[model samples]
Target: MIEPSDGAPPDSGMTLVEVLVAMGLFGVLASILLGLGLSTQAVTEDTRDRTGVNEEARIAMERIAREVRQSAGLDSVTLPGTPAGHTSTSFTFWTDFNNDGARTNTASDPEVMTYEWDPDTEELSMTAVTGLATVTRPVLAATVTSFVVEPRSSRWQYDQVGGACSCADGITTWRELDNSAVGNYNSEPDPQELRFADLLFVSMTVEDGNGTQTYSTQIDLRNRS
Candidate 1:
């Protein structure tokens, strides 16, 4: 047994081993907290990127679809030039601006709307041609990788009254108007046939810092009877 002398001071401070152990525990806790904070920040950033990309795609697709649905027909002549066997990265259509059931070609009646994608600038733009002299252009979306519009037509034969023939005797299949070629529709000999598109397939791809996202939707023409 060890007895302290009357004059010796009592031990009041921690030993070196105790201090070292405390410091090691503190270091471990600090490392764990830092890792958690980093992980949370990374997750938040990823979520923000995804949300931004999705919103961009949604807005563009919705705008196109809304206009297509309200349109009375397509305008093939307004599209830009493209090589043979390739689809034009642009689309143009006519809508009854006055909301009349029938299409009117006047400046204030039926409006021509054109959507063009610029590959060099990665921008999707829209142009509105109301009359021979009035034109307005706006950028619809940015950071666009690709924009494609495919028009499909019904193969069913129609009678003189504009009603489809008997299904059993007439063709009932729906066929691609441009034969799966982008610019073929615009180059068709009869411009009148381009007046209506039974179904419009809108597809767009957008890229951001996070990655690329594609959005697609089908729009049925209201006045395509």
Candidate 2:
């Protein structure tokens, strides 16, 4: 058919411009995919951080609840409200935290426990003295922003005598135990009249670099009573 036309048929192949356009579209899609992947990674990291903070708070709060429910001698619940030479800002306490309400004097069973937070360092440290037993537990590794312990006593009375605590002198300032606070149970006139079946309130707050979290619990101290 008339020697092959010098110019090839019209629709044989795409022009260079068309190919370039297709390549550009593919690149755009790839860029979108990359952006989505980065976003997902960031979300996962944030969730992990929040979960870790919650677990730490939960562990510490649970430990405290268990010990409190089994608290035998509320009278001996020594909370260091002020540091030795410090003012009312310093609050610490030593009480029976074991499942058994018995106080341990020897290294085997430590009955006395102390919880304190250093305002300057923000460190929450725990010291326990059982019968021949000594154990120190840390509540937080970093600087603690806040720490508070309110006893849920059935009796509104607090021992407000200005004298040195049994553990150490040079430290005075005690309040009569009371249960007026909600989630607390110091409303009972006589502790002996109250049973272990009674309910008590517990609240706590903890903070880290990221943020702060609070824990509230109601427990029956009969087992520890």
Candidate 3:
């Protein structure tokens, strides 16, 4: 006769310890995947922030250059330099704002523009004055950390513009952003003239949560005599 049958059939399922180990391993894998996903998302956000800051800075610089170039007379300009005579956070000028070959800035129609930087608020703004009405608008708020305007006289050699100049359009290359008037188009002494300078060395730095970018341009003022 065969031996007596075992009390229970052979065990087919895992033991308690094995089940617990498997559960722990699965938990570890899930945690690792979650961590990697979060890391990737953070990197993407940072890159976007940096790109936005750079683009914003570039736009601000171009705006200033465009307006200054159209100006016919500079009332006053403040740049950063020795003796404290050339250093200031604001510049004022009267744009040529000609109405299609017509004259502008008469006794009752004079228009003045000013660009001012506030260090405490980290803001840059533009102010326009027409006769007695004055309006101030924000240009680049909370992005521009520094705005320095350096005034230079005409006629520097091409080879010396880069090395001797404190700024350039981009990457410190010496380039005339725009051609000037054919000749001394306005030879008369303009009441708005300041130091009779024609070139503006603009340097600005912008920063955000991501990073900072600095841009510089040599803007050739219009209506130079």
Candidate 4:
């Protein structure tokens, strides 16, 4: 028997339900791909943030160390200790941090380089003083979280009073020594003069919030100067 070809075409396509199901499948696949892309982006950003923080810390530490190592004159050096009979943390001295041969006050002329923190931005910055006077200009990276500077001196009692003893280039060990009878560098102070005794310890921490990533570096200032 010859089957009559139906004028109506045979069911040439999927049913409504089948079509809907296929669309749903495509949607699911697209969503999965999108999610993967987003994940990759997040990971990349995190890595970049971490790397940037670490690099910033290293640069800051190195710069500080270099300046300290080049510190000019005995009086130019100051430690984070009490001066003579004064027991105050506000005690600071002058140093030619830029190797300009003249001592400049922290706030005055013959300016050098200094690292200062910004309270509003929670950042640490380096500024170079221009001209013969104390003019300042920015240099290097910013966005630092915590910057702490600790200076160790020759005399434990008067670390600020007597200048860093045994101040020499290439000396690596530092010790805390006792004060002299007449307030001078004794032949053998308790803390042997090395990098650390006269050294300024600069510690900095930088971070990015999203990943809670942090970078930190500890540098001895005496070695760099």
What's model 4's overall lDDT? 0.48
Please give the ranking of all candidate structures by TM-score, highest first, separated by commas.
3, 1, 4, 2
The residue-by-residue lDDT of candidate 3 on 55-138, one tens digit each, is: 777787888788788877567654343214433477887666654443343545545778888766778888877555677788
- TM per candidate comes to 0.65, 0.56, 0.67, 0.57
- Specify the highest-TM-score model's number: 3
| Model 1 residue pairs with clashes | 87-182
Per-residue lDDT for 80-123 in model 2, tens only? 33223542122222345454444555565555666666666667
TM-score of 1: 0.65
Residue pair clashes in candidate 4: 65-224, 68-225, 69-224, 69-225, 70-225, 175-191, 176-191, 177-190, 177-191
Stretches off by above 4 angstroms in model 3 are: 1-11, 79-88, 100-111, 155-193
**Pick by TM-score: 2 or 4, better one:** 4
Model 1: residues >4 Å from true position, as ranges?
1-12, 15-21, 77-81, 84-88, 100-110, 130-142, 156-193
lDDT of 2 at 55: 81
Better of 2 and 4 by lDDT: 2
Instruction: Give the TM-score comparing model 2 with the true structure, all chains together.
Output: 0.56
Task: List the candidate 2 regions with Cα displacement exceeding 4 Å.
Answer: 1-16, 74-102, 105-108, 130-135, 140-143, 156-202, 207-210, 218-225
